[model samples]
Target: MSKRRIYWTLQIIGWSVLIMFEYVPYVLEYGFDWDNFYNALINIVLGIILTHTYRLVIRKWNWSSLPLPSLGFRVVVSALVLGLIMALINQPLDRHTLEQNLLDQPLVFWGYVLSWWKSLLAWMLSYTVYHYLEQTRLADYEKIMLTMSMREAEAKVLRSQLNPHFTFNALNSIRALVYEDPAKAQIGITQLSNILRNSLLADRRKTVDLQEELRTVEDYLELEKVRYEDRLQYKILADPHTVYWQVPPMMLQTLVENGIKHGVAKEMGGGFVELSSEIVDDVLLIIIRNSGRLTSTESTSSESGGVGLKNTAERLSVLYGKGASFRIFQEDEKTVRSEVRVPTMSENPVISAKEIRSF
Candidate 1:
């Protein structure tokens, strides 16, 4: 039910119980007294209206934001005032007694205030618990929305970086082919078009299935192969069971571009590019191998230091923290390897994005 409806329902039930408790004793003691019933009805109605009005005032001033000690003092003062009002409202019922004057019997007057004070304090405690729980839930919901927005924004920046790097290299190859081979250049344009369309889709999503990322990478590699011709040979190996796991879009494509730019394309013989994916111990492991010698200045050089590797590292850290890792090093003099490992998680993953506000 809505909060407004719940508030009114509890209000009615609470006041109804208070009214019954007051009037039932009078009915049992003196067979049917309209005077006693009238006082009980009026007292209950005034108590409900006054307490609800006080509640509205507390909400208007946002008293819940106050420090614990200040809030407790305010609640006690309000309850004491409400209890005094209830004692005054029920005063006419005591006119026939020996201690008829509150001025003469001050102890009796304090006894009524003390009884009502306990009842009002209980109501205050109930309201405090409900208000605190509601504040906690609102805080959690805002946190989730903030995290989703940040991840979407970071993904966009990473894709933007990768797209230009891939396109510049592809267009460069196409420019050279135009004078040497017109027919192949035309085909390269078509492959580039197809790859860009897939990239546009990837740019719009935070994550896509592993199969979709692999397909986009294959399209990219196909465009590269048109330029490398007889020198570039590639192999892709993937476990069928790992196809549906979610991965950052275009991640593999960026890695493949990085490998070719630094490794295979620079080699004289232009050896094979090997890409593989496997699931081991609840981790999705991707290995990209290419033929090139590892050099000391590879990462430090401004010209060859493409944004792909750096973006990959940032994205992995943002998305999975300790659960993901990206590393690139030379396996041997003839072969350099880039390896990535991310937790093999299912769909509808709940990630705690609180610590990753840097992105």
Candidate 2:
């Protein structure tokens, strides 16, 4: 039921029950006196009205937001005041209707006040504590939602940075082939177009299947090969079981491009870039071995892969937090290895041990 309906139901039931507890015993003792029953009815009506009015006042002043000490003080004071009002009204009514001199006995008058005080205090505390807990739960939910939104925005901004940087490097590779080999340049343009189209579609999604991402990476490698020719040699390997796993879009291509740009392009003898993926303990492990050395400063600095490595790390952090990892380190005197490990998505196919594919 709605809160308003629930509040009204409980208010009526609670007042009726409390009043009946006193009246029913008196009725049993005095043989159903209508005058006393009428008195009990008036008391019940007054109790509901006074408590409901107190509810309105509490809400109007937003008393639920008050500190515990201040709210406790207000609750105690309000209950005492309400108890006095109830006693004053009840004593006069009982004296006039039943010829009872309740006020003549201070103990009897104070007993009524104390009983009412206990009941009113219980009601106020119940209401206050419930609303306070509800407010705390809502605040916690909003904080979590805000944190998720900020992370999503940051991931999108990081992805945006990667796109333009990638396009610039791809265009430069095609430019080198334009005058030297117009025919190859034409093919390079087509490959670049395909890669760009895939990237545009990938932008609309947070991740894509590893199989689809590999196609984009292959196209990018083809375009780079047009510029480097026989000087650039590369290989791609993937475990068949892991091909269906999901990874951040364009991520693999960025790593491959980074390998070629920093590894092969700088070497006197054109170097090799090797990309590989395997599933180990339900995690997708991707490793790229390139013919280059990474200095300590280059591994963490912007100069390492020209924002490519830095962007990759940030995107992984945003998407997976500590569940994913990326690092580049020198594997040998002439080879640098860039490694990434990501937890497999829930939608990934059941993995089975299979032979790795090479292309």
Candidate 3:
């Protein structure tokens, strides 16, 4: 038997035996003495053995076995076991006590039979309760595993949808530059192509190194610079430790694109977009700030000419859920900032390596 089964069986049988012993003395006082003390001890041991056998039988035969037939078998087995136990103990019990009870009448024989049935009832009840608890425990474990599986599937779907959407926006920037400056447009196309290929490769992954994401962002900014000329400038500052941290693949690129599209691009004269990464409170903190305001109106409708930001938020929500936080708000009259915080996976070498891997 498993340790759990053995331990529970002993615990149940031990308590039941104690209760029987306590009551047997009182019954003896009522002249119902069929070796009361000896009989009670034997019944406790025999009942436990019978319960163990029943457990084995149920596991092997299956619980769907016909109820009437099973119960009949149980009752017959229990009676035989109890009678044999009582007979063996009778010799060790006081012969005087048995003689006294039997000399009076045959009523003592009926008492023995009743006691045997009572013992079986106690054993069956305890066994049933233990088995029911085991089943409940197993069911709860399966439920937890199922919930995790569903969440993982949802995360993967959101990641897949967001990646292509991000690439499409980057291509739009290159397209805008083509008519005005074919030379710059050629360079932009090259950068955009490289970014697209990397993104497509990373899509096969659940997450990538932070350094890889930063390189992709740099490529995107270069393409944007061609469109806005000197009017668009950007800076990247990353902590060495955090640069090697892992994040959802292509996540940082999407967020950086949003800062450029909604925040920097919104300025008629164009403006600088600054990206920074640091470790705070044992978490990796990323900030994307640009020279545009995030008014309440902009926050309400992401698709209201701000598909980039909307798409980024959706991806973040799906990947991290409540485990991470994403917030966009106006930093000042001329600046809007998107801040994201995700748990640091400091101990995982593979994850750490991915985070730092460059383009």
Best by TM-score: 1
Write candidate 2's Cα lDDT for 14-114 as tens digits. 98999999888888888888788899989889998988888888778978778989988999999999998987887655445324545356687778899
Residue 117 Cα positional deviation in candidate 2, in Å, after optimal superposition: 1.7
Q: How many backbone clashes does candidate 3 have?
A: 3
* Residue 102 accuracy (lDDT) in model 2: 52
Which predicted model would earn the best lDDT? 2
The full ranking of all candidates by lDDT, starting with the best, is 2, 1, 3
Can you give the TM-score per candidate against the true fold? Answer: 0.85, 0.83, 0.64
lDDT of 3: 0.68
The window of 10 residues in a row where model 2 has the poorest summed lDDT is 350-359
* Tens digit of per-residue lDDT, candidate 3, span 1-359: 66667766675767476657766678867766766756666656655665667666654564423365675566466556655555445433587765665666446655665565565556555655555455555555556556556756765665666666666767777887778888988888888888887777765775678898898889988877766878899999999998888787777777776667667777888899899999999888999888887755466365532444564565555556665777878888898888888775322122111221100
Candidate with more favorable, higher lDDT: 2 or 3: 2
